[model samples]
Target: MDGTHLFELVIAMFLAIIALHYLAHRLGLPPSVALLTGGAALAFVPGLPAIEVDPELVLVIFLPPLLFDGAWSIAVDRLKRHMFGIASLAVGAVFFTTVVVAVVTHVLMPSLPWAGCAALGAIVSPPDAVSARAILERVNLPRRLQILLEGESLLNDASGLVLFRFAVAAATTGAFSATNAAGTFILLAAGGAIVGCVVGYAWVKLVRKLHDDYLMIAATTLMCWIAYLLGEQLHVSGVIATVTAGLIASWYQHTVMSAATRMRGTSFWTVLVFLMEAMVFILIGLSLRDIVERGGGFGALLETMALPALAILVTIVVARFVWIFASDVAIELAHRTGLARSVPMGTGAATVLSWAGVRGVVTLALALSLPDAFPGRDFILVIAFAVIMGTVLLQGTTLGAVISWAGLRGTEAEGAPMTMSQAEAAMAQVQFAKVKSLAFDTDGNLIHPQLLRRYEHRATAIIDYAQRTEDYVPMLHAHFDVVLEAVAVGRTELIRLRRAGQIDDETLRELERDLDLEELSAISAKA
Candidate 1:
């Protein structure tokens, strides 16, 4: 298709995504799932030109920022607190699922190469953060449970994608060695982490010197790409690299960014991530026809690949449950025998975690990325799509019900603590200090009692007062600076609370948002 056609199609798909997302929200369905359905419908439209995406471009453009955002938003302290459990699920469960899916799928489709099966397995092993985040916003879960799941969501893609790269290499080169693969995986992971840290350090240091608002925002996006590209160039795990950069950046975000910069950057990232997510789901749907055609058409694809794909889908879903439950049981046994002090999660929470394994854009992107000459490329792609649809449609839609059935819905109790007002209430000390410390202007002159009294009618400064008197503008700005200082103190306290385990990540962030607005309001007070 021509560039004009491609551009038009993109616009059309974007419009469709907006409409479907709204529809899904109204109907209480997952938005990502709705976009997938819409994309599939658009695919079969008569006379519409085919939309072909370069897999390299897709990964390069889409994965970096998404991964970075996931890394940046994840609570490092909570992640550390729950590290062991998160690792077992994010790393162990993913590998276990990959192996199980590969073995079972090989049995179901013996003619398909083992390497291809492994690649397919890896494709479906990781759950997408976008899908989980959407549902999570609508329902609450226990703090520990939410931490485990969200943490897993952040790191599993790295593990699964690393495995995928190995599998694809094995397929392309007709070589397979578990020993070498394991060694390389470890080396790559470590190298990616190091590279990511360096990249993140450089980004923060560079941005600290920048004063322009838009440049700072643009630099963040650039930093994500740099992390991914550098990792890839260094022959490490780009996914891990990007994620590490994000994590480090998030840790220092408050200290490094000006209040206005932080607020604007947050808004920019929120919109960018949402758009990237919407486009990815729709692209997968739009690619459905091509996938089927390459697999020998719809009827032939069903006849040849349907059963094996079904078998693979079931294997991944079941494998997650088996591994999680078994691990929980093993942990429980260890604790009972006094062999370990780590407490096992409750069965209900375990069940909910296992069932929440919904595949999404990452799986589809991996499948689509397979080289054309790779054995069973089309077949693997179709299987990946099937797995994504099955998990998302079946598991995503009903995850809340499962949580409720498991008696961990957290509908009332868990939801109340993460509120903005709660965060503000926690900052009563800082607020009091802010008011008491507001006696002096920028020149350190204590205002007369009458001057303060006349300005006491409002918490916010009146812009007209600045026009009426030159001294009043500077005085108000000085008060704004005091407000900014108060915000800084609030941030320090928020960080302290997070580190001391006094507040959960959700609450910390909610409080951070409250302070951000206060700072912005102070700036606007004298604008």
Candidate 2:
């Protein structure tokens, strides 16, 4: 397409996304589902150009940032606590789903090569992290459960992509070996992680030397792309590399970068992720036109492939449910026998987790990446698309209701208590003391007795509120709102002063940044 048409297409997609996103929010549906539906509908509209989605662009441009941001936001402590569950789902369950999908597809389509079937299996196995997290945002779930879901989504793409590469190689070359593939998987995962950490450490050091928010943000963006590209060039898993780098960078950022940089970086990444996700889902829906046209239109394609697509969708859902239940049962048994320390995984949690498997962008991208000469490529694409649409539409829509029905709509009782970190409490105490000291003269005699008394009272209140108990939660929230309001007012005044020429732009910005940092801290405390 020429530049004019391309610009028009981009504008149309954005307009559609904005409209559908608003509608989705109002209707209590996942925005992704709404976007997908809208894009698909647009495909049949006359006078509208077909939007071609390049699989390579999606993988290279979209995947890294999305994966990195998600990984970066994940709490390291939560990952450690739910490591077992996350692994069970990310690695073990992904492989299991691949095998089940391969076996089922092979049985249903005997003429299709086993290798090709395996490739298809790997393509569709890993549920999309973006979709799962997006849907879960609307549903209340236990913290540990949420952690497990998010962690699995973050990690499984690497495993799935690794399996996909091997399957494709085997199919294309007519060669397959389980032992060799296993070794390759280990190398890709471990090597990619090592590369990510080394790169992440270097990137963090570089960022520490930079003071400009724009430069810091630009450098972090480059890090995601560079990490993925470097890992791929080294013949390892780019997904793992990007994920690892994001996690390391996130964990060390506070120590290395200013609070201003962190706050601005967070906002930058949030907008980037939102836009990327919006385009990905809409592009996914738009790509259906190509599939439909290739299969000789929608009706003809459905007539030929509907049953197989339905079967594949059912198989994917069932496999996830089985694996989740079995893992929970094994964990329970282990805990009872004192063989291991495991949190009690109730039926409600298990059910919710099982139903939360919604395939998304990764599946579509990988399916589209299949070589033209690959056996039954069109068929594979159709089935993959069907599974993605079916799971995301059916499961995504009902997940909240399912959670409600299962009675899994609260934070887990057995998980870590919700309390301020000791480090945070200490920092608050220090700040309070500093402020109180400012209310006194250099010799420590109170210059403003009322101010000294007020600071002391607030400090005590904060200290008491920081204690781990349910009773102080409301008081803590009230304190946070008050602090946030004060910071917000300070920011407004700084902006006004700059506009009125009472303060220079530089001074206004510096003071405004301080208030922004304070605001972020207060908001974080409330969360």
Candidate 3:
């Protein structure tokens, strides 16, 4: 496509995404599902051009930011607590599912080589990080379950893709070694993580010297791409590298960035992730045209390929359930015998986790990347597409219902209503004391009685509202907005004073930082 046409297509796709997002929000459907359906519908529109997505470009452009943002947002403490469970699912479950799917595919279609089946298995094994997170955010999963899912999605991409590379190589060369592949996986994961840490540390040091929020945002964006590209060039797992950088950056940002910088950087990443996710799903839908065309049309493809596709999809779903339950049982036995320290996994949590394995863009990209000469390439592609659609459309859509049906609602401890109330009460008392203390200046001179009275009244009202009302959140929000407005006005005056030579730039900056910190605190409180 020409540059002009490409630009036009980009604009059109974004517009469609916005429209579909609104529709999905109104219809109470997942945004990914809406985008996928919209893209498919657009494909069938007369005179609309079919846009082919480059799988390599998808990984290089979309994967890094998505992975980094997810890692950055994940709760570090929660992940640490559940590291064992997350590891078993992310690494072990992925390996097990890959093998199961490969066996089933080989049995169903004997003509396809074992290597090809393994490649297909690896392609669809890891749940899509973007899809899982997007759906999980909307549901009311228990805190531990949510963290486990998020952690698994964040790490499994690296494992699944590493396995994919080994399988592809084995298929092409007609040679394979379990020991060699295992060694390669370790080297790639460890090397990628080390590289990410070095890069993240360098970025932290560099950003500390910079004061511009926009510059900080741009620098982090550059860091993600550079980290991924560097890892790929070094023959390590780029997904791991990006995720590592993001986690390190997230931890270090609090120390290095000003409040304003951190807030702006967060907003930038949020918008970027939303756009990337929307584009990926829509593009997946758009590619349906090409897939259908290659198979000589939808009806012909289904007549020949439907049964195998359904079988593969069913196998993946069943494998996840088996692994989750089996692992849980073993963990329980170990705990009972005092051989391991582990919590008992409830049936509800196990069921929800099993049903949450929805495939997405990565699977489609890998399938499309298959060589033309590969055995059963078309058949493999068809099955991959079917599985992606089936899992995402059927399984993704019903996951929340399944969680509810299994009676896995958030527990009282997980909800933490009592803790939240206690915190709110403590915060109100602290603010009330601060307001009362503000009545006098540093010179020990009392502020004007009228102004002092107004501050005291507002503070007292907030405290009473917090103590008496179940719905005090709105009152708190109003109080926060009032403080924010006052801080914003002070910041503007500080800038004006510096511009008029009434204050030096250094003094102005010092005062501005104070205001920024106050504003950040208020915003955080409201959130």
TM-score of each: 0.80, 0.89, 0.85
Residue 147 displacement in candidate 3 (angstroms) = 0.7
- C-alpha RMSD by candidate, in order: 12.0, 3.6, 6.1
**Residue by residue across 220-288, what tens digits does model 1's lDDT show?**
889999999999999998888988899989988888888778878989899888889889888878888
Model 2 ranges with Cα > 4 A deviation = 412-418, 421-426, 432-454, 466-527
RMSD of 3: 6.1
lDDT of each: 0.82, 0.86, 0.87
Please provide, for model 2 over 1-527, each residue's C-alpha lDDT reduced to its tens digit, 9 standing for 90 to 100. 89998998888888898999999989878898899898888887898877777787888998899888888888788898788889999999999999999999999999999988999899999999879767866777888888888899989998899899889999888998999988999999999999899889989899889879889889998999999999999988888999999999989887887866777788888888887888888888888888899899978987999999999999999999999999888888999999989856788889999999999889998999999899989999999999989998999888888988888755533344544454456666787788776877888787877766766676676666557547877877898999988988888888888888998988987788778778877888788
Locate the minimum summed-lDDT window of 10 residues in model 2.
Answer: 411-420
Error (Å) of candidate 3 at residue 200 is: 1.0
Model 1 local distance difference test score: 0.82
**Candidate order, lDDT descending:** 3, 2, 1
Clashes by residue pair, model 2: none
Task: Give one clash count per candidate, in the order shown.
Answer: 0, 0, 0
Question: In candidate 1, which residue ranges exceed 4 Å CA deviation?
Answer: 410-426, 430-527
Number of the top TM-score candidate? 2
